[model samples]
Target: MKAIVCHELNGPAALRLEDIPEPSPAAGQVRLRVRACGVNFADSLITRGQYQVQPEPPFSPGFEVAGDVLELGEGVTEFAVGDRVIALTLHGGYAEQAVVNVNRCVAIPPAMPYQHGAAFPVVFGTSHIALWHRARLQAGETLVVHGASGGVGLTAVAIGKQLGATVIATASSPEKLDIARQHGADHLINTSHDDIRLRIKELTEERGADVIYDPVGGELFNASLRAIAFEGRILVIGFAGGTVPQIPANHLLVKNVDVIGLNWPAYAERHPTVMTESFRILLDWYLAGAIQPYVSEIYPLEEAVDALHQVVSRKSTGKVVITVGD
Candidate 1:
């Protein structure tokens, strides 16, 4: 199997492609002939040794994949060989074949393509957990999503609208804002050209947004607090803006707002049943054509470095994937 191996602590450009031995499933894992691998911002961080869960040097850097099961590990009865599946592997998905825990794998919808299934788990899971569970977003309420053109951002926008919220999407460019509009965002705000706080307030008649889905923390996170409504819930999804913002307690206290932190991986580990149920709902929406996992570009497995670089550059309108095999 050929995999993208990171032997040193460098960025995506330092990732190397080389032939590696295929992995076999353990007692609770299954081996997959990887069809596509999803590249994420975490993949870029892991390659640069900046992510929280850093595997040692000389490890593959992919978090999610979709493929056909090659062989089932012992004690695995829910899946079988040749079944198309998507799994949330911690790493080692940017290759021809990989091993993943059975619990982390879910049967992809029959109508979904391999590329979408590969891209679904992380972003969709995050959006579902953040909006439905953490924030408890309500129907007819106004929701604002920052970085609304990125993978998880777009998912949040779509899910917000699906759940009956008047979705307001924010991006830095008009093109990116257009992407969010096409994905069901009821309103769009280009942060570069307009004042997010002013626009959000203007759109909602100064009541502010009922829920703010902020994955790109930093200055933007701080400003979002100003646009939050009374009793508003701000879901903190990530720190993609290169800086993590510090929360001032006074702001929350004055507005009677809540800042909810959404740690998707930790939540999945701590609440297995909830994770499974969340994915099931996402799959249900996907099968009904209620949601679509957008893949802006697909690169071959050997081009994993370029794929990660694209994601790191923050230029992708949707998810970027690696085509591992047929």
Candidate 2:
């Protein structure tokens, strides 16, 4: 097998594509002949040893993948060998084969392409759980999404609309804003040239947004504090903006807003049934054409580092993936 091996926490630049022995599944796990892998911002963080669960060294750093089942370990009976599936792995998705727990693997539709299947799980799951379970976003309410052109952010915009919220998307450029609109953003605010607070206030008729889905925190979170409606909920998805925002407790009290910190990995463990339900709903939506997974670019397995660069540099909208085989 071939993998992008990281022996040190020196970031994506230090990642190297090297030939390595294939891994077999342990108990309750399945080995996948990986066809495509989703590249995430967390991959970059893991390379720098800044993410939550750091593996010791000389490991690949990919989370979501789509592949064919090669073998199933003990107690794994839900899927047969050669099942085309999407899975969420803790790591090791950057290789030609990855081992994931049986619970994390979901069968993909025969019609869905491997690239789209690879891109689906993490980003869509994050948004679905954040909006529905954590924030309890209501229909006919106003929803604001920051960094709306990025991976999970774009999913947030689309899911918000599907859930009957009036979606307001904010991005740094007109091109990005256009992409947001195409994904169902009812209103667009250019963060670079336009004022987010003022535009959101104007668009919402001064009521402010009912739910703010934010993956890029920092200054955008500060703006959300000011722009949120009374009793609004701000779901902190990530700190992709580079600076982590320190939430002011007083601000939450003033408007009775809830600043909810959403970490899906923990949620998935605590409520495995709910996570499975969420995936079921999302997969149905995908099959029904109610949601679309966007892949901005796809690189071969060896260029996995470049895919990570595209995510970290904010050059790619939606998802960037790595194709593991010919």
Clashes found in each candidate (C-alpha, N, C closer than 3 A):
0, 0
- Compose the digit string of candidate 1's lDDT tens values, residues 164-230: 9999999999999999999999998988879888999999999999999998999889889999999
Candidate 2 has its poorest 10 consecutive residues by lDDT at 262-271
Candidate 2 residues lying further than 4 Å off, grouped into runs, are: none
List runs of model 1 lying over 4 Å from the truth: none
Deviation of model 2 at 217, angstroms: 1.0
lDDT of 2 by residue, 165-279 (tens): 9999999999999999999999999999888899999999999999999888889999999999999999999999999998889998999999898779775577898899999
> What is the alpha-carbon lDDT for the whole of candidate 1?
0.90
